[model samples]
Target: MPSPEPDDLKRLAERIDEAERKHAQRKKPPPPTSLGIAFRFATEMVSALLVGGGLGWGIDWAFDHWSHLQTRPWGMVVMFVLGAAAGIRNVMAAAKELNAEMAAKDLEK
Candidate 1:
């Protein structure tokens, strides 16, 4: 067979470079640490709890201020319960998100 010319070599090199780039693009990323996941979950839980408490307190105060509605302790109890539920929901959501994020991170490796 005839020797490959300079142009052929250049084209081959270009093809190799393109392949490498494509491979890199297809490569997966690394996963996150266990500690990092826990930290993120905890952070979200705390934030949610704080927000829920504030909202509940505000609602309770508003209800307490209204003369006609003020007679009801049910409002306060309901708001508190709802806030706690919301806080718990947020914590669960955060945990799920954190796990997903960590899984994605691991896949990127």
Candidate 2:
């Protein structure tokens, strides 16, 4: 078989280079979005607050009835305060997550 001509080799090289450039351009994926992060954070915070508050209320009821009648009032107050703290913590965590997500999105673009 005859060897390929220089012109044919050059054309083939150009075609290969073009293909590689196009592939590189197409392979790049879009950056992550913050909307998904925000939604997830809000969902988690709301769920945690609800579950924590319910558990706190239940424990307070049980303690008031069975375990320690003497400390019932204080226990109830403490439990309620703890529940509130948990809720506040959830909110703060969500806020932090949102801030981080926003920062990440900004950096991406």
Candidate 3:
């Protein structure tokens, strides 16, 4: 068999270097998005508030619509307060969850 030329050896050396570089490289995962986390947090907080208010309104309607019943918007007012509390609670929970996730990621690194 004929020996390889100088040009061929140079090309082979370049290919080996390229292969070694690729072998030494590691794949990095993409970071989690803050927008998505914020959206979920907001959604949880808002939905809790909305659902609480809605249920309160429903109770108020039931009381008013019944015969021989006289109740002011007190149900709505009370429910509104409860809903606000629930929203606050949900927001706190979301914050805790996010913090935990971040802590876990830091530990990973």
Better candidate by TM-score, 1 or 3: 3
- Per-prediction count of colliding residue pairs? 11, 0, 0
Our tally of clashes for model 2 stands at 0
Cα RMSD for candidates in order: 4.5, 5.6, 6.8
Per-residue lDDT tens digits for candidate 1, residues 1-109, read 8886989999999999999998888644555678876787677667766666666667667867865466355555665567667767877887787678777777866
Q: How close to the true structure is residue 29 of candidate 2, measured as C-alpha lDDT?
A: 41
lDDT of 2 by residue, 1-109 (tens): 8887999989999999999988887344454467866676667666766665666667667877787555545555665667667766877886786678678768867
Candidate 2 off by > 4 Å: 1-53, 68-73
How well is each residue in 1-109 modelled by candidate 3, as lDDT tens digits?
A: 8776999989999999999999998875566698987888789878978887788888888888884565557777788789888988888988897788788779978
Local distance difference test values of all predictions, in order: 0.71, 0.69, 0.83
lDDT of 2 at 70: 57
TM-score of every prediction relative to native: 0.56, 0.48, 0.65
Looking at model 1, report the run of 10 residues with the lowest lDDT sum.
Answer: 67-76
